[model samples]
Target chain A: MKEIRWHGRGGQGGFTAARLLGMAASLSPGYYVQAFPSFGPERRGAPVLGFTRIDTKPIHDHSKVYSCDYVVVLDESLLAVVDVFEGLKADGIMLINSARGGEAFTASGRQVYTIDATGIALAVLGQPVTSTPMFGAFVGATGLVDLPAALTAVDMTLPADSRAKNREVVEWAYNELRRKINA
Target chain B: MSNEAWEGRRAFISANDAVSYAVRLCRPEVIAAYPITPQTSVVEKLSEFIAGGGMDCQFINVESEHSAMAAVMGAAMMGCRTFTASSSQGLMYMCEMLHYVSGSRFPVVMMNANRTLAAPWNIYGDHRDSLAMRDAGWLQVYVENAQEALDTVLQAYRVAEDAAVRTPAMVCLDGFVLTHTYEIVNIPGQREVDAFLPPYAPGENVLDLANPRSLCISVAPEWQTEFRCQQQAAMEAAKGAIARADGDFAAAFGRRWGGMVEEYRCEDADYVLLGMGSVMGTTRLVVDKLRAEGLKAGLMKIRFFRPFPREEIAALGRRVKGIGVIDRDVSFGNAGALYTEAKAALYSAGGASPHTVNFIAGLSGRDITKEHIETMYRKVMNAAAGGAEREIQFAGLRWEEW
Candidate 1:
């Protein structure tokens, strides 16, 4: 099973991105996926968690993810408030949506990758929400789902008026991270 | 996951949304339900469907949960297929009407998102909401996932509207855990659901002017005993109706939840852990893990609580050496309600071979982690091997005192 935890504030569309990941992964025949939020005291700016579990077999565990394969932070500001690395596996990768360099957040024993998801979101979606852009970066960082599947998920999840822009955001982050990782 | 797509109607949706799709397919003439957290999404989705003209049903915007049940009961009284839903405090608000619907022999089906009751003021998943209504004269069915939640809604209509069992049924989904959680669900075609459920044949149980019948009348002590006996008989008859509905549903939909209780890997098992709803899903994984480690572990999932599966429990007791009952709701002063009922069912099991331990956890939506389930299995293993173990143990407790 591949578990990814999304860290973002309330109203950031964190859960939407989590669900899109599940939808993208489950597009194939062999994959089974589940996405759920840590729902509590939900407000505009309170810290929240959205989790996605993708696996070849059906997921039977209903509990919160304690060990994650990847942790995607939609808001870099959440780094100071929440311990995003609490349940991160030793070899797990941490994908952050920040302008800071990856080395700034990278601990000695951790793999930390940074992407200007908000910058991409601002440029592409004309919005400050990093969920779509970070979603792309997640796929780029993990390669959990194919590029076409990720774009298809954006199209399936977004409204008709915004589908094109959101798809662009996903492709931008995905290709950017792919380019960086290859370099 | 099966390789076959069932014509590829698969979609990713929450269990609450799945219930909305199932309710739409059932073609209920009247849909009435008040909004409540977790459950509010189901109500919203249903309203969206009705607004979009996807369903030809009267959507009742009731003032309160009490009126929600009353509206459905009135519609059902007129021989109209009806549906309603509630959860937590909302379900408690409909307590009076719960008995009224069941006592009047109205086959009103409801979807309840199982949530923790408020005193500490929580809005999370727990079985306490449904277990508290154990004697409400309604048939309670708990589901494991979005697919079961959808399939059971159709089967609930079938079982409830059965001529033998004219009992109201409540299909429960664990709040937030199952309700808000999104998963890829195999949505069956509406034509298939319609074919399987057919239509709700009223069969003379209606308040019609031409029929000239008195309904919802009070029965005096002279005949109240017989009325109660008939209700009890209907409850007993529901056991078979539930099984038959599951069997027929399996034939039609290619999925079966083992009727009342699904025993997973029970054959040749020494220790079996029993639970209900989503917790059982987690427990099933733990059971498999234990089996892989050479421990004879099994999972007994209680699907139906109202028509308690005692015969199956007794049969399981006769086979296993130790049985662990994991209940998400406790009966307050006593042990977990599920554990208490399982023990009551195991009263006449000849010799005291299978030792019982109750693990009360996941109250108020606390995470019943894999480790917690494994701990329950370990305790069951210990008790089965004649090792000392507490009769009732709480899993994942912050402070382990008594």
Candidate 2:
């Protein structure tokens, strides 16, 4: 089973991103999936959590994800507020929406995929929220889910007028992952 | 009924844990409850299940009981079986939605760990919590033990979600007495529980976005009275539903007890002690002691307090010589609330109202011993024999002699 925890603000579309991922996972053969928000009376800017569980076997345990194989952070501010890296598996990957300024990292060498999803979202989608594009980056980092499939999931969640920008951010994240993997 | 076995089961869990297991068996599509003492553990357990992938339900840890009830109400309105748990003050906090859940006539099962209301601040077992919300149009049943707590919660879903009478019900067990007390509860196997309670269908929920309808909306006084009358009818209807559900539960689980009131040695009795919550267990022990001595005294466990179970209570009043209502909760100035309700139920019943004496004991967890029960019974017998005037009295209270 693969468990992914998404960290973002309440209105940053973390819940939508999780569900879309589950929908995409559900469409895939040999996969059973679940996606849901951690219930809290969080306001728009409050940090929130959404969870996704995908497994070949029928999942039986439904406790919070104590250990996650992948952690997607839509808002960089979450890292300061929450112990975002607390339970990341040794072989797990971290996807962040803050890779724009070419910042180098000396953090542990598991796998880190960063995309300036916020910049892409703001310029293209006209909002700085990075959940949808972060979903693309999440798919890009692990190749666990198909990039095209993840983008389609993102498109379904976004309104039509803003679909083009979301798709662009997703495409850019996918390319960034391809380049990082090749390097 | 006692020896029926479900193996790989016996979990020495708290009343809250038993409640959580029952809720899981109920298969609520949406489970929402806020964290409050005694009640919090159940929600925490379910949250663990939903989080760990054990239960496939939307477990919501809402900000308050109000939102918790709101979330469940919304889900239940959309045809999903819903659940929540709360205690004394928490139940009071969500009083508004309590009416909404039942008024909407949605099948939402709530487990209330009866506790004393705060001001002086007490968190122990008492009926003041559930008793306060008694008239909010919900079917209320009290359980004395952990196993009953578990079974009744599952049955509550069956009774509440049933198409015939789709009103919300509170399966109340005493706080700490059951909520915190650890006991061997036979958690029913999934298949057997499934057979007893089929998956809840959203047939009654009128919410179809395509064809929208508002529920629990304001109505003219005339229309409102009609709705309340319907609510009253449904509560009384629950007396039958409780009987049927208990029978079906017995047939399916081999655990059966007669309807709303569980009678213990009430037959041919001259004196009966009426009680609810865990104190009933104590009362039963007292009744047995009295019965062993050849005293024609028995105990009546008042499980359903809301629809008042007027007929059953009236019949008990007619049969018994003297009736003592041992209330673990009070209606404040009026003394024993349950006792008061029972007296009202008996007023219309013919005979000289069974010397109904109210014993307000076990408030905020004061232990009611066998001696206390015997004393209370003697008082009732004296009252019945001499036509004593004391209607409300305290059974066990500390006093200093001058």
Candidate 3:
């Protein structure tokens, strides 16, 4: 089983990204997925968590994710208040959405890939909804799911008017992060 | 019963929305509800489906949960199938109508998102809301996943509306745990669900102008006992109706929710953990881990709490050395409702009454983890093997009042 915990403020669509990942994984008959948000009363700017678990068999454990394979940060400013790496496994990766161009490092031979999904979102969608770009970056950097499947999930989730640009940003993030990972 | 070639499609959705889709397939005539947290999305989705031309049902906008129940009951009495949903405070607000709906044998089905009653003002999930209404004479079924939540609504209507059992049914989903969680579910085709569940035949119970009947009328003291006895007989009859509904539903749809009580690998096990709702899912996974480690651990999922499944509980009590009852709600001064019921079921049985323990866990939406379940199973196994026993063990506590 692969578990990913998403961190963001309430209006940032972190749970939407988590749900999209699950939807993408569920496109294949071999995978079972669970996507859920921390069910706290959502206030506009309050910090919240969302989770996605993907496995070959049905996922049954319903408790909050204490240990996770990946920690995806939707807002880089949240790092100052929240421990983004708290429950991350030793070999797990931390993917962040930052436009400040943070240094990418291999820590203790584990991958810590950083992508400027905010920059990609602003460049492509003209809004800072970084969920789709980060979704694409996670897929591209880790190869967790196929790009086509992830793009299909985006198409299925977003409306027709918004689909084209979101798809473009996802592709841009996927390519940009793939280049960085290969480099 | 349209049986032309049909197939169920798979979709990823929340239990809340899943109920809406199931309602569309069942084609309930009326839906009246007041939104509450964790449960708000269900009616929200249903409204969307209605406005989007997906369903052609009468949507009653009500002022309060009390009126919501009253509206559905009135519609149901007029021979139209109906649905309403509430949770926690909202459920408690409709307390007066809960009895009126069931006592009249309206067969009105409601999906309750099980949540905690307020103390310090919490909106999280727990079973206190629905379990508090246990004696209100409604059939209750707790679902473990989104698929079951959807499928059980279809089955709950079938069983509740059956001629032998004219009872209202509450299909419960754990508030945030099951309700808000998104899962991939196989949505039975509309024609298929229609085939499994025929249209609501109001029969003699409904209010018809041709043969008018009085309902919700006060009975005299001498006649009330017979009314209570008839309610008990109807509940007893519900046991068979529930099983047949599930079995017949399995023949139509591909899934069977194990009639009343679903046993997970309990035949050869020495000890068993029994619970309802979403915690049982975690227990099932933990049971797998225990079995892998050569521990003879198993789980019994009590699906319907109203019918009680006394026969199955007694038969299992005769075989297992111990049975642990996991309850998400406590009856204040007494044990959790499920533990008390399990003990009562075992006390009168003729065969061996296994040693028992009550685990009062997951109160006010506290996370019931894999470790908590494993520890409970170990306690059950240990107690059965002549170890120390605690009558009511509250799992995952930082410190205990006792």
Best by lDDT: 1
| Per-prediction fnat | 0.77, 0.00, 0.79
What 10-residue stretch in candidate 3 chain A is worst by lDDT?
Answer: A100-109
What is the C-alpha lDDT profile of model 2 across A86-113, one tens digit per residue? 7889998877777543234326455667
lDDT tens string, model 3, B182-290? 9999888877887889999988777878887797789899999998898899999999998898889888877899979999999998889999999988888898898
Give candidate 2's whole-model lDDT: 0.77
lDDT of 3: 0.88
lDDT of 1 by residue, A140-163 (tens): 988899989999998778888998
Error of 1 at A168 (Å): 1.3
Once superposed on the true structure, which residue ranges of model 2 sit more than 4 Å away at CA? A1-183, B1-8, B387-389, B400-402
Q: Write the per-residue lDDT of candidate 1 for residues B192-265, one digit (tens) a residue.
A: 88789888888888988977997777989999999989999998999999999999999998999888989899
RMSD of each: 2.5, 17.2, 2.4
Q: For each candidate in the order shown, give its overall lDDT on alpha carbons.
A: 0.89, 0.77, 0.88
Stretches of candidate 1 above 4 Å error? B1-8, B351-353
DockQ score for model 1, please? Answer: 0.83
Docking category of candidate 1: high
